[model samples]
Target: MAFGRNKNRRRQDAAQRNEAVKGAVRSKGPGVMKVLALTLATGLLVWGGVELRRWALQSPRFELAAVSFSGLQRASRVELLRLAALTKGQNLWALDVGALERTMLQHPWVKKVEVSRRFPNRVSVAVTEHVPEALAVLGELYVLDEEGEPFKRVTPGDGLDLPLVTGVDREGYVADPDQARQRFQAALEVARAYTKEAVAGKPERLSEVRMEGRDVTLVAASGQEVRLGEGDSEVKLQRLARVRRELGARGLAAEIIHLDNRARPGWVAVKISSPVSERNGSAKQ
Candidate 1:
């Protein structure tokens, strides 16, 4: 009987061990399945990403269709495209916008530019060119932009019917560019103020703006000169027009009008040359 009991005990222990092994496997089965599923998903995502990129780059749908340019003053579209090294039928996604902008800036006229990629295979470029404002006589005549930068040498073929800015020479400009720019800007300011006023009921035309060391002088198209010392430019210009009108009423022509009175506002000294007698006299108002 004892021998029979020992055999039964061994059978029960073996069954218990078998159950424990089965339970452990069942607990780990879901974890293993989760890992396999996660790996498969990651592989699919990577493959999809690569395929999408490839399609977008190489597909005809992304091919460049239209290229639009705006704010181009002197730069032609063909020239701009040549500078950009870009053409239509190329892939839009393949073009680097920043590289193209930097390239376009080398056009010698473009100052500020923005290149962009539009949706559905379109590219747009917006450019701002340096506009010619005045002519600077710096040994060699050069063109001055609005920002007082002397950009290029004046050519005969260029339509440079602009106001002449004198007094800042090439030597002085090369020595101190910042100070030279201030002189140019001062001349331009006088030019701007002169454009607003009329003389003797006719439109005032500016021929030259000369910066004469802390004083600005304007020579009109009619050979009349006006000197503005430092500040109150617009007011001085208005006063000049009034003086010209008063002189015109008396049948007298003003050779020069001095408004350079910092101490005395509205004080003007006029040099008159009578057209009838060619006599010159000084008048203060």
Candidate 2:
């Protein structure tokens, strides 16, 4: 009987050990499944985000509907659009703003460009064109800006009244931009001085300004050549004004006026056409 009891007790202990093992396995199963569920959820979210981005990029809603321009003075809208090469129906998100900006700036007349995209379907372009201050007479005519930088090539029907700047070669300017800039500044100064109205209320309209090395020569609208030596341009211009007034008072017109001699600031040497009385007397003799 005691031996029977021992066998029964051993069988009971074995059954308890089996139950503990099964319970432990059951406890770990939910935790493992939770981890797998979290991993699957994360993967699904990432895939959905990528797909949504792709759809948004290729969607018709992002198609460019219009392109607008502003601040354009010289550059035409059609020309700028052609240079940009941006076509309608192109995906706005796919369009490269930086690339378009660089292309537009390639136009010499376009000094600066601002490119931006309007959400839902539009591109805006703002262009700042180079303001022409004068015409530089190179082999071919070119436009000069206020900073004395040549920005564009000139064509017919342009700058009819602008003063012509001569004695600077295009090749030389390209080789030495700094020196060319200085020359342009000097020419601009002379042109401005010649065009400015003096205290006598008379403005000298210049047709051409020639830069001979450091000295400047001005050709007035009346076809008189005025030689202005380098430096002290204001003083020289004042003297020129006085000379002009004196000539008008004396009923005399000069063919040429030389103010280049710095030693004689107050003296002006003028060459005038022979008076009518003198011409008549000589004819009689």
The total number of steric clashes, by the backbone 3 Å criterion, in model 2 comes to 0
Q: What are the lDDT figures for the candidates, one per model?
A: 0.85, 0.83
Q: What does candidate 1's lDDT look like per residue over 1-285, in tens digits? A: 999999999999999999998998899989989999999999999999999989989899988988999998777889889988888898987889899999999886788889999977899999999888889988999989888999888877676678899889999999999999988988887787677665334645788898889888898888888888888788888888788879878887777888997789679988875554434543433
Off by over 4 Å in 1: 1-43, 198-201, 262-265, 274-285
Off by over 4 Å in 2: 1-49, 157-160, 198-202, 273-285
TM-score of 1: 0.77
Tens-place lDDT digits, model 2, residues 94-134? 98999999999998888999999998999999898877777
- Model 2, residue 230: distance off in Å is 0.9
Per-candidate clashes, comma-separated: 0, 0
Query: In model 1, what is the error at residue 219, expressed in angstroms?
Result: 1.4
Q: 270, model 1: CA deviation in Å?
A: 2.4
